[model samples]
Target: MKIVELKNISKRFGTILANDDITLSIEQNKIHCIIGENGAGKSTLMKILFGIYKQDQGEIYIRGERVNFRNSHDAINLKIGMLHQHFMLIEDFTILENVILGAELSKGYKLDFEKSRVTITELIRKYDLDLNPDELVYKLSISEKQKVELLKLLYRNSEILILDEPTAVLTPIELKGFFKILNNFKAEGKTIILITHKLNEVKEISDKVSVLRKGKLVYETDKEKIDISELSRLIIGDIEDIPVRNKIDNGQALFKDYITVKNLSLIENGIIKLNNLNFALKKHSVFGICGVEGNGQNELIEVLIGLNKKFKGEIYPEKLVPAIVPDDRTKKGMIGEMSISENYFLREKNLRFAFKNILKNIELKFIKRFDISVPYSGCKVKYLSGGNQQKAIVAREIMLNHNILIFSHPTRGVDLRARDIIHNEIISERNKGKAIILISSDLDELLSLSDELAIIYKGTFLKVFLFSELKEKLESDRTSLLENIGELMMGVVK
Candidate 1:
């Protein structure tokens, strides 16, 4: 059954046509994906469907019945729910309160808490979501917070769920578990509309894929026709091969360690966060760390960046100048209220003389080099979308030319085209003799860029191999390395 359908949807902002006569269909109980480069009308079209944005011209149908939505509440009342890329829960509220804030049960105008609590508890247990109803949202992990969002949708009894970048914050293992939940939803005949940049997930889970390019529907196909290369080409029209790191000139050249950790460990809340971690990276290569989240990746990055000093063992070059693209860019990477130029010139001592001129120079240089589309350089960063904000941050950090770059989930929430651009820049940095430590759950990305690969499990390095040593073996059988590395992450050393 065609559960949802859009006919000739068109939207405009100022003189910009965000969506140009777009049309698509989403089937009943199927995982339908909408993919595109940034500003390719995916979000705009979804917003129109959710009633966040009204299309200037279009017809929407639900269950073969024509309908119009004036606001999100109308869509919500129609059993539609949306999960945004950035979580939308208030940190100060408890899980139950957050879930049932607007849709509260009442007896004689007084608040009815007991009934809602029981209902939410049942939903949590049914979904195998290990979360406490009494717990505040502030203290929960990224994965747990995401579960709360899911619970909210269930609380409202939404059958058509729209998810935006749903797995951006999840670990490799958490992602697998989440997909199982989605599968269960499918089995139960619930429809899912997923918006994601991860093409592999689209291939693995989506029943159908609809790709958009520059506000137009460029391609549409079912999973049976899914191809990674074809999907990439459809998303961006073209793409380059995965980057292979270049080995240094001298065969016997001493690759000095820019950052070295020996027997590093951290105990938090009577739990060993990291257990005797050890790794070394040369000055001119990318060292990729592949691990399930919460296995001490954050602590290790903290140690390297000097954010957390209470740990056992040594991180040499104690005073480190590291440029980091953090996982939670909004929280840790850059200040949102600050202007792009302000973010660029922040903490610079040399710009005191002719500060305005220097700031303009920096802003113009970054905009030209990184393809940052901004109304004006003086605009605050918060107003930009997730992808644009990320690009601006990447531009600032990379342009700084720091010798050591710590890219934590470098291309987490960006589009396919943006992912390619960032990958190219990371390779460019490596070629310039700047060492990089890439921590990501994306295996293909790691394989594409790493000179050395490290598989981390349970706060320990289960295996680490230089790409050169495994080159011949990987060439003989490509799937062998993926299988071995995947098993290692699962705590099985096959």
Candidate 2:
């Protein structure tokens, strides 16, 4: 039986038709996966279902009964829960307190802490979450915080769980465990709605799959009939090959070192954040750095970008212009309140007179070139979807036209099509004799683009693999190569 149904749904945002007469259904006790490109209206349709947005035209039914939702509370009352890409939790509160915050157990006009703790502890044990309820939320890891979000929904007796890119923050090692947790939910007869960009994950966990493209439901299939290539084609309406790193003649001989660091080290609060790092970034090359996040990636980027000058290092050419696309777009890359045109020329040294027109023209050019879907050049960037926001930041940074480009997790929350576009642009820049630093948690991205790959762990480079060497190993022993990289990332190998 269908647990929830949406029929003839349509939504619009000003001039953009976010959802165009779409209809979809969710069956009971099955893991349903939704796939789509950025701004393809997948989120919009889901938001309408979750009561965050009311459709301009449509009818919703839950278990054969018609319903109208005025806000998220209405959806919650119907036992529906959504986990967004960014986590929602109060850092200062304990896990138990955060979980039972809005819906606390009451006894005789007083909160019943003991009863809530017992119930929460039982839930944790049943789900194998392995989280201590009394632990403070501020000290939790990324995965732990996500588990807390899940606990919140479970505590409220949510039967239909909607997760948006929940696995994006997890490492390859953590992903397997997280998927197992999802399987646990499914085994317990819960209906799960997963919105993700990774096709491999969809193939692995979904019982049924649906595709949305340009605000329309274009395709649907069962797990037994799913084809990844066909799904990709449907999402983007065209098939494109994975990006291949361009080959340079005579390797490092044809390129000059744009920046070199020797004996680079950083110590903070008596903890060594970076240790004796020595590397030279050469023009026309991509030096890839891959590690489990929080293991010196931030420290290394900070030192290189001159954000932290307290580090011990020898940097050549003391003055350098570096174009950086930071991992956190909201916090570091762009101002949420500013218009696209304003953020585009945010770093300009001179915008005294007639600069508005110049900025507007620049924004228009990039909007056309990058295919950014914004209502207008003056739209606040925060209003754009995650992928479009990323595109805007990338466009602005690339238009800076600097010789040194630093892209940190550039394609974190974007779709496959956007990923391809960004990857191609990175390669194009490298071919133009621009030195690039590619820092990412995605091993596939690193392997696809890097001329040389470094595995950093515990504030040190455990190993650096040359492209030629990795390619030979990949051609001969692909499994062993991945195993080696995985072990290196976890600090299991010296």
TM-score of each model, paired residue for residue: 0.87, 0.92
Off by over 4 Å in 1: 56-59, 64-70, 90-97, 105-114, 125-141, 171-173, 226-228, 238-253, 347-349, 353-364, 371-379, 466-473, 476-478
lDDT of 2 by residue, 305-325 (tens): 888899997999777779999
lDDT of each: 0.82, 0.86
Whole-model alpha-carbon lDDT for candidate 1: 0.82
Q: lDDT at 148 for candidate 1?
A: 94
Question: Residue 444 CA error for candidate 1 (Å)?
Answer: 1.6
TM-score of 1: 0.87
Whole-model alpha-carbon lDDT for candidate 2? 0.86
* Strongest candidate by lDDT: 2
